[model samples]
Target: MSQRPRPCRWLRRPGSDLGLRLTLAAAAAVLLLVPFTVLMLLVATAWPPLLALDAHLAATLHAGTSANPALAGVLQLWTDMFAPGPLRVLVGVVAVWLWWRGARRVALWAVVTMVAGGLLGAGLKLLLGRDRPEFLDPVSHATGYSFPSGHSLTAALGAGVLLLIFLPFVPDASPVRTQRATRWTIIAAALIVTVATGLTRVALGVHWLSDVVAGWTLGVAVIAATTAAFATWRGLPARRSPQGGSGRPPPRDMPGRT
Candidate 1:
């Protein structure tokens, strides 16, 4: 008589390293959230020092940008390119591509991260009801509450999502130097984009420094939360595969896996 096939060992016992990564991700989320919460309280209370810093930077940048129309124009263009709406669309396209490539879980995680970040940013904006910097000769104009900069939040989220999704493809193998170079290059590029987005928003005089900082922290925190949740659900470690493939290993239950 034919006997029933046994279940895959993975299903019976999850990867051993998942718990540590999950804990780390959770810790990251809390760490990011703490500073963001503090900032929110300070902004809500109109803390004198924070307000003074915001005024000082906004005035300084405005003075320079307003004098140099060319620089202001360039910053405006950069801000438009990295706006939350465009970034969300780009992330959606990437999610579709990921799904087609059989990284459905990662794709889903990407979608969730973008959607959650967008909603959270908007909610905070409404809750705070903060005003954008007002200038007699404003270098740039944005019509919305501006406690946490939407552009900054979206840019950070976009960079982070792209990094995590593509990291698995970095060949971490025999060529140690090449692998390190590739990984650091990707990391640096992401950092540059994220930081530049915030700086441009501030230089354009549309967002305060604190606004940009809050956006950065919140965006990262959201990513960490989702990553931890996904890792736990999949019973997989939150790490890139040694094989330099997708972000996570295919479970035995997956169609192409054996």
Candidate 2:
């Protein structure tokens, strides 16, 4: 008699499936909650911890301005690179490149994520109507409501989308260890860029510390949600053509079929 096929080994692995399920659930929770928290904080104007942290950070950064004019100037330049116009241009270029390479799905994902994140940030700014930091001299000048730093949000989204698009290109070997290492390296580099961009806004005194923090958190939520959506799409079963048949020959009969 024929025996039943063995269950998938991954399903039998201890904790792996549970861990992934929990992680995804937590990410969804954060994605839903962070924006609401930011909005409520803006309305209440009573986020004591964030307020105190903002005051201390802004004061510390401002105090260093005279002693480190050159450093301040460098940070100003870095912060400017994340401005909305520059970020739009950068995203446009990347999306076009991905399209040319036939990564249509990823290209569309990038454009949608960037545009949605920008609109969300802008809507928040207009709705909140919070003013920029004026407690100390600003190393750089800006205009507009400043509850969320647009530069920080754009930087995080751009860096994150690019990383996600390129991650699949890292080759996986049999052991899987090398692939994990490569992915971690890319993650580390992206984190550095995102963190530096947020910190520069604070150092320039154009945004309160809380604004940058909120921007980073919101940006991360957008990225996490986008990634989850993409993964779900990719996991879906492929559909047959209108003829009700697969377009390709049976895998076992195809040349070099795995």
Candidate 3:
């Protein structure tokens, strides 16, 4: 009769398997981000028309700018801070702080993702060399070529990094995904911060809808790649130390055995 290997005395079943499962999920998620990256690549082709998309988005906002005053106010705050100013700096600091607390690897990934997004957006903007809105009343003022909005790029990068920071910790309950309250809360916060901040660009009249989409695409791709790398590294469980220093002795309780 075959016998099952006993669960390691020191090993916690679900938590121990978590790294491997998360790595797989991160890999799968990275595959998903590829299409988004392609779309961002296509931004070069479609960028010229973004002025029109911006106009449409602006018209919609202008038509009924404040359906939910409270919500509008919240969104307004985001719009005000869409630039690479003090607010941006504050956000950057918070993101870095988050990465340092529980997961240094993740925090580093966030920084990489942001830098990647910024560089990608800059290159695309220069290549496209597109013009800004012909007639403008943007909530935020902008100069130079416009297409993939820098504001949107930074926001997406920030959000993507935040999501990556939080994703692994969530109680996935499905073999690998951990679900802890703090993780879920942070995940929700990250999504809110990213989406809200990205939209602020549109409201402020700086970026077209297409620009945000592209930024989101590129940002997600960068983050996915970062997460995939982390996942790959973490997939391997820690080996029991020499002399089994890290290993725990067999459990005192045995099934149907005294």
Per-residue alpha-carbon lDDT of model 3 for 130-248, expressed as tens digits?
Answer: 66543343444668677667766676666555455445433334443344556667777767766776777666555666667766666666666655565554444455868866464
RMSD of each: 8.3, 7.7, 9.4
Q: lDDT of all predictions, in order shown?
A: 0.83, 0.70, 0.57
- 142 in model 1: Cα distance from truth in Å? 0.3
Instruction: lDDT winner between 2 and 3, please give it.
Output: 2
Q: Report residue 47 deviation for candidate 3 (angstroms).
A: 8.4
Enumerate clash totals for all models, in the order shown.
0, 0, 9
Q: List the residue pairs that clash in candidate 2.
A: none
Sort by lDDT, best first: what order?
1, 2, 3
lDDT of 1 by residue, 10-102 (tens): 222246777787898899999999999999999999999999999999899889999999998898887888888888898899888766655
Q: Using lDDT as the measure, name the better of candidate 1 and candidate 3.
A: 1
> TM-score ranking from best to worst?
1, 2, 3
State in Å the error of residue 135, model 1: 0.3
lDDT by residue for model 2 over 125-221, one digit each (tens)?
9978887877545577889988788888888888877776666556544258888888899999878878898888777777887788778777777
TM-score of 1: 0.86
Task: Tell me the spans in candidate 3 whose CA falls farther than 4 Å from its real position.
Answer: 1-34, 37-43, 46-54, 62-76, 82-103, 136-139, 166-185, 233-258
Runs in model 2 deviating more than 4 A are 1-26, 29-32, 35-43, 173-182, 232-242, 245-258
- Residue 35 accuracy (lDDT) in model 1: 100
